[model samples]
Target: MPQTENQTQVTDRPQATKTAILVIGGAEDKVHGKEILQTFWQCAGGTDAIIGIIPSASREPALIGERYYRIFADMGAKEIKVLDVRDRDGGRDSAYLHYVENCTGIFMTGGDQLRLCGLLADTPLMNLVVERVRAQEIALAGTSAGAAVMGHQMIAGGSSGECPNRALVDLAMGLGIIPEVLVDQHFHNRNRLARLLSAISAHSDLLGVGIDEDTCAMFDSDRNLQVLGRGTVTIVDARDISYTNQNQVHGADPISIHNLKLHVLRYGDRYNLEGHQVIASS
Candidate 1:
């Protein structure tokens, strides 16, 4: 059953000063492994942090649940709860709300982003998630489909490697936990350069981040993003890309791409979103 408007009261937890949002492209187990676990350990302040997993995007609930259970366990999270947002009860169950309220960190699993958004959007659960991140200083992280839903505008639906036209692109409102930038996952593997470039061309003010698999870009409270894992995060900026025939194009028409800045960041490399500078070299 679809979620109703009113189910539970929004949480009023006090926010923390230091908060981090980790966005992973995919293949979390293969990409960072022990290091990823270690990062979570350090971010949560200990091995015994209260962690919650939202795997509503996955079609196979048992597989998704087990995958997260093992991942968190390997990361040394003692108290981990997997919230079943797909419950026929309409996502308003008291147990689900309780876990969301108390969790120190919430991780989103990769699958169908649209499914995940459908289950959480406009529900009291989503409101609590936003509140927890702002007020309680909860660390929110997502891999693949999980990563795609962090920004204000998400690529809820799009074709792979295809140059985006107005009709080819499908943008949906996201959780808005991260702002200004649009994120694309499995970037290199999927040859998503054209799609991201097209998105930047359409919205000149927004930044396009194409994250490779097995890698993560962690945005800190100070708006500094640090890259981690084996792969790279490519930042595409077409703010200066001059074009005249944007509206005349139809299917995969070539558009002039100029003044585009591309940055490939690796582990330990930090980029300042506010200043658009590479602070600490990887």
Candidate 2:
């Protein structure tokens, strides 16, 4: 039987001050164990978690949002509500912004990353979300398109399943939740390595994160990254890359880069952004 939205109760307790964000690669296995959603629920606030779901990125907001509402309810969320940030005006409305006060966590559903950012970026809603996250008032989780928008610089559009090419990829400003990093979802299934490699060529200072299907990378305010779920997370480290024709290259041509370090971590693996170390589980 499907759980009703009423199952969640509002909590009056003081909010916890530990900010966290979850970046899911997309197509999470919801039925078998619901591992990702369950983890998100616990991290958000467990029984006291009141999740504010934003479906603005999706073309079919209401129709697509029902799945998450029911899933969160079954997972014991104190309250779950879907928001419609379909336009710039809606994002600025004070009435809609009130949802953030009662929320312990905010979940952004997968869809078109551009649409999500386009409508909310630089708006009051996004400002509030970021403020709450930094204050540790709530945690944020997003899958697929939601995951893509988590970085400071995002891959707006690109060609996949090919050798690295700089011109074919288009980069854009993201919501900037995760600093000094770029996130790409559905990595393994989509064969996005080439594109991600090229993306790093453009922004040598950023770490390129490739997350696999049904997998996730959780980042804490301390900048510690942990891998979870059934799949893996690939890290494209360009910090040590000696050289690249990326800057000089023009048109749709193969990019040449050297000494780009790659790290592939599976479930339970951890990474420290400040220390730039991989803390693998034994």
Candidate 3:
């Protein structure tokens, strides 16, 4: 028997210093202004930042890892290390774990979400990263596929350019860094609003956060999610959804959902994850 309406939520928080998690949509501005990466650099301690890059999600780990390495190096980071772990065994390598332990910031590059999880999930390295982030020992940031893996309930794959339906999206367990939400990257650019809406219709308990390209949903230690970038962040709140036919709907059948709250936020706008309140940009 499955639990439908009463799924137990994970309640865990960092009790130490303030923490920040930057979830960036795909194709961030890396050459020109570099605002998003700059913000991440500042959050991670600016010039004193000891950064670690996880390029495991990418097919060309060396290439992707070096690209970020050059980016951070050019940004005047104190130290930057690329941890290109390809297999489960690499996750346990003491050297990589040592760098992660000492790192002030960790960045996961964009690539294959499923491949990323398949390589690192439940491993000692992944567990350590989660533990450190929760303890406020490190600032975490992920782009694209990396962003998709920030939530406990992740959208692994889905079809776009369609109405909300049961088969519009595929869900998977993510890193659980932010367990109460589901993240979708390259949002509007890929026309994934319906995909996210379909996902929320099924699991109405989780907040569906859809981030547009180059944008970021920056979640602080206090659970205040702030929008930053050139585009908007769409929040789908179904906590008070009056009706949804997800349970009754089968594959590809359109689902009906009512009373769902939608918020489209831009730069400097904030949303409290704990209370589900929106704070408009001044």
Best by TM-score: 3
lDDT of 1: 0.73
Q: Mark the 10 consecutive residues where model 3 has the least summed lDDT.
A: 1-10
Candidates in order have lDDT scores of 0.73, 0.84, 0.87
Top-down lDDT ranking: 3, 2, 1
Can you give the lDDT of residue 79 in candidate 2?
A: 89
**What TM-score would each prediction reach against the true structure?**
0.86, 0.92, 0.93
Off by over 4 Å in 2: 1-18
Better of 2 and 3 by TM-score: 3
The sequence of per-residue lDDT tens digits that candidate 2 reaches over residues 1-282 is 112121122122112224678899999877867777777888888888989899888999997688899899988889888887788998888766888876889999999999999999999888899888878779899999888998899988787867898766788889998868899888989888988988999898999999999888988777778877778899999988999999787777889989988889876678889988998754
Model 3 alpha-carbon miss at residue 219, Å: 0.4
What lDDT score goes with residue 33 in model 3?
68
lDDT (Cα, tens digit) per residue for candidate 1, span 1-282 = 111111122132112223778888887653233455446545654576788888888898568877777777766786888887785454677887888787788878889888888888767777788788766368888889989988888887677644555545567877787868899999898888777776667777778889998778888888888876667799887666666355577666765566778888866677888888875451
- The sequence of per-residue lDDT tens digits that candidate 3 reaches over residues 74-168 is 99999999988999998898998988888899999999999899999998888999999999888999999999999998999999877999788
Q: Give the RMSD in angstroms, all C-alphas superposed, for model 1.
A: 9.7
User: Residue 264 lDDT in model 1?
Assistant: 87
